[model samples]
Target: MPEKFVVVGAGPVGSLAALYAAVRGYHVELYELRPDLRDPATTPLNFTKSINLAISERGVNSLRQTGLTTLVKDVVSSTTPMKGRMLHLRKQGKYVREAQLYDARGKNLLALDRTSLNKTLLDALESMPNVKLFFHHKVVGVDFNKKLAWFERRTPSDPSSRGTEIEISFDFMIGADGAHSAVRYHLMKFTPVAYQQEYIDKLWCQFHVAPSPKDGKYRLPPNYLHIWPQDEAMFIALPNQDQTFTSTLFLTRQGFSDLDAHPDRLVAYFQDKFPAVVPDLIPADELVKQYNENPHLPLITIKCTPYHFSSSGVIVGDAAHAMVPFYGQGMNAGLEDVRVLFDFLDQYPTDRAKALDQYSKVRTPDAHTINDLALRNYREMASDVKSPLYLLRKKIEETLDVYFPGLGFATQYSRVTFSNMPYSEVQRRAAWQARVLNCAVGGLGVGVLGAMWVWGRGGGWARVKRGVLLGCCWIARGVVGVVRGWE
Candidate 1:
């Protein structure tokens, strides 16, 4: 007999957990506070900038491991492949452009609607015999001691009629209900788990660039993720399947306050600073209205210990480690968590408690590590993305990568976005690699000066330049060849 499971939340993470457990023959019941989102009437994430999320190797490979790759791919399509970030800077009456590639080989991540991904997973879940969905039902409480869940009735419309509570039972429960998870709250009754929730003062407002008027194609490069780096404030855009782009503006607390105070001046701000993008996309009036009415939502980060209760329940996804979306790892990491947990469960089928314990033990470090890296990456995206020296460094890194092959380390962003290397190990390797780069730059600088000094006599500068180039070429060609030959 398969284990009977209760999965909380119908969002992407919960849906994936239920999908996998059911496929493994577990009788799974999924609960969601929202309406059956399948109906268009649910009006998914309406006109928001949190439109699409970046999906890369970690997310895709995990889904493939479960054999659901084709189902998901059918509903989602990728962008043209942005070699790097396209920074839009205001200058005079126009915006200047700059580019920075994410990968040394120029590969990039893909962006697809978050709702589209969720709906596709839900569609797959609905088709399964072992999966059952309970929508528009809010989970009010959890009784792990009795393995029971308490719910309040709700309707698709006006869900919070605040009805009497009801109860259901399951053999085991999985919580993917996100940061304010009721399950995590309830579990604290039985065992003490340290928790911290930090509201990052930086708030974000989402906007969109409708498909181009000319045949509804992209106005900008559909393949590249666009950025507007304005020092302390920045905005970014990612492509969508419908030939549109979802843009988000991130500002500090005071920034939002000032926007709210002088809502009418939004047009002037856009006209003065974001001229290249404003006229092409949102009407100045509509943009100001959005700023006035839409949420100036602050990002939240949550960290906790003991993601699971002894034998009956466990927390996964944002429920365990809620992070800001800056690194674009929130959803991907959640999906990866589900995959890793299920693999462990299968590995120790009979010893389920052991599996839950191991899940927490193995995942906690990765969760915390990635959360920190994700927070730090905001500076890179908002400021470093537009720096010339940074782009030059990236080009140098790419040149080395082409010659060195896989004997390399990933940029912090690449480590999280392009691969699923162990989070802690990735951090360690990246630190060492940065040191190597610093040393290389220093050595090259000194060598150049020495060559220049020698050149002052006659043609020393020319000889030195040649020598440096030759040395770099020799090192690259020799190391790459030897490395390739070994492989």
Candidate 2:
């Protein structure tokens, strides 16, 4: 008989895990705390707004591994390509828009609807004979040693009744439950896992920008992710399939509270900072109403170690490492976890315990590194993205990539979003590039200062100013020469 594999949480990660196990001939039972999202009576989880997802190479690679080519194609077909970030900035008392390409080589991120993609995966699983999806079956407990798990079943007929408890036996269990994971909580009884959860001060509220009434077309550029980066907060919008855009406003808890008290302030705030938002992308009335009606959800980051309990059970996705959505890698990383875990299982098929052990050893650091990167990216999205220094570094990196071609030059964003290279390695390379840029910029500044001092000693301020400008021009020429040399 084939091994019975039990998966808790029928979200994308759990559904994908069940699909993989079923493909391997394991009789799979996928349990979820909620009813099937595709059901009419079941409301979608993100009812406040249908958030858009940026699907890049990492996520695409994971889907490719599942052998569900048709499903992958279906999901990809529904997406809009976000080729770059269209930054809305204030310059000389007026707002201007600038496009910063993600990659000079024409690589772009796919903007996908979260619900549509999840439904695609769930639909694919429903067709599989070996996979049984038990919706409204909430996992209550687990005994890894006994290979037993407990769940409470909720019947649709008796919505108010206390559910009946059911005990199921499985050869192995996978936990893809989210940050507040019941599976992770129960598994801790069997394994000594190191766990940490943090709620960042930032809270996010979703908003919508409807299609233009004039032509029934997109109000903003549909090809780029729109960003309004203010120091204390940020507003971002990603295009959807229906010409509408799903926008989010991320702010500190106190900022949300302040805005809540004076609802009128919301419109004025946007008008002052993001001058084009009101009466342009979003109407003045709609913006205030959405702010009041939509829930201000907290952003969280979670990190845990020893993801598996011997051969019997393992945790994947948010259960292992939940991150902030700033980097848009939460779902991608979770999917990658499924691929990596199975890769180990494939390697040590006979001794599953050793495979689980090796998985924990190798995947933990990468998970933590991504969690950190996500946190850092929150600051970048909100503030540093518009900084002159940040743009300069990006220019340097992209210049090298454009000119060098085969010299292995790449931006951190490209490395993280456009490749399957490990997250830790991406972080390392980004840091190295940062150091090199710092040294180059520092030398330029020192050269300019030295010239200012020496020339000003006799030539006065005007000549000194001219000399400093000339020094900067000289540095620019040298950088251009390097680019030319590479070509």
CA lDDT, every model vs. true structure: 0.78, 0.86
Q: Candidate 1 on 1-487: residue-level lDDT in tens?
A: 7778999988888988998898899999998877876787765543233536887788777777777757656544533355567878865655688666778766678786777778788988999998889887788888898888899877556775886578998888999988889888998887789888899879988887788887888878877888887767887888776787788888889988887788777777766656576677776776877777777787899999888887899999989999998888898899899999998889898887899899888998899998998888888888877677877776766676678656674466677678878787778767766666665666566666667766776765578787577546544543454344322
Clashing pairs in 1: 84-100, 84-101, 455-460, 455-461
For model 1 the TM-score comes to 0.89
Best prediction by TM-score = 2
Model 2 agreement with the true structure over 201-255: per-residue lDDT tens digits:
9998899899999999999999999999997889999999899999999888999
Query: TM-score per candidate, in order?
Result: 0.89, 0.91
TM match of model 2 to true structure: 0.91
